[model samples]
Target: MRRAAYWLFPLIAAAVAIFIVIFMIQINPSAPHMNDGTDGEESDTSPQITEQSGSWLDRFSISEEKGYFYPVNEVSLKLTDGGTATVAAHYRLTVPLKSSYELFCVKEELKKSELPYFMRKEGETMTLFVDSNDQNRLVSLVTKLKTYQIKATVSPYTEEK
Candidate 1:
């Protein structure tokens, strides 16, 4: 009787431990529920990417406004040949200096160019907008800007259809 009682005590403790483990697993919030159509099952509504889809972009839907804008550093001659019409690539160049002296230098350089540009000062940063369609002008602007140690980034601006 003593031997049986000793073994029984350990057996009961083991059973309780196993029960606790099972209960914890069942109550875990992070577990992904399966789609078995049962009370605890989760619906398989999450988006899945398949091999047939070229990229994540194919699976996702993008609005008209989000698709076209690309920043340009240097002028590129590439045109949107097929899907949509693109007017120009926008560029952003930041001069490290915020002083009016530096700003004046930049303004003078831009004034020397024949290309049409829209300039605005926001705080210490200067924003220059140029038409993307004119590849020659872009090339010239990029070349000239580079001489002044000003690097520009080309962003795409798409025309709405």
Candidate 2:
């Protein structure tokens, strides 16, 4: 009985989580397959691309007020072609692992800050993906994780002599 309890608890928790997700999805306004201009608004902004359009760059409409607002630490792109509209939002984050840091601590810290994050494997120390759109939140997360001498850097720039 003791051995069975170890597996049973996790299964129950997973089931509850799944149900909650389903419930949230049902109430969500922008759930999948519901954004086909069914809300009585014209779909002018969500125009389609055609072969006659020539270059894709010409179709891009970007402005300061109604500019394409992309989420930080996230990638979301909306593309239209002919009679179909596609929305793709994907998450990709990586933080270099310079020193030893416990996975549990990182997780707890993210949770405390109310950020969405997922860890693939503890063995993969160099990759930590935290889902967030707010720039300040992302900055705060980096600051909180600075328990040691960890610095985010890009490729070294070469200067002309």
Give one clash count per candidate, in the order shown: 12, 0
TM-score of 2: 0.32
The TM-score obtained by model 1 is 0.32
> All models: lDDT?
0.59, 0.57
lDDT of 1 by residue, 1-161 (tens): 99999899999999999999999988975634433456877655544534354453443433223344334466556656688785455543333444566556566776786545566777857666655455555666667767767666554555569
Candidate 2 C-alpha lDDT tens digits along 1-161: 98899999999999999999999988874623434466888655423444365453443432223434443475467666678665343333346554455455666776798777654556645556765445556666667667744443222222249
Off by over 4 Å in 2: 1-93, 97-100, 121-126, 151-161
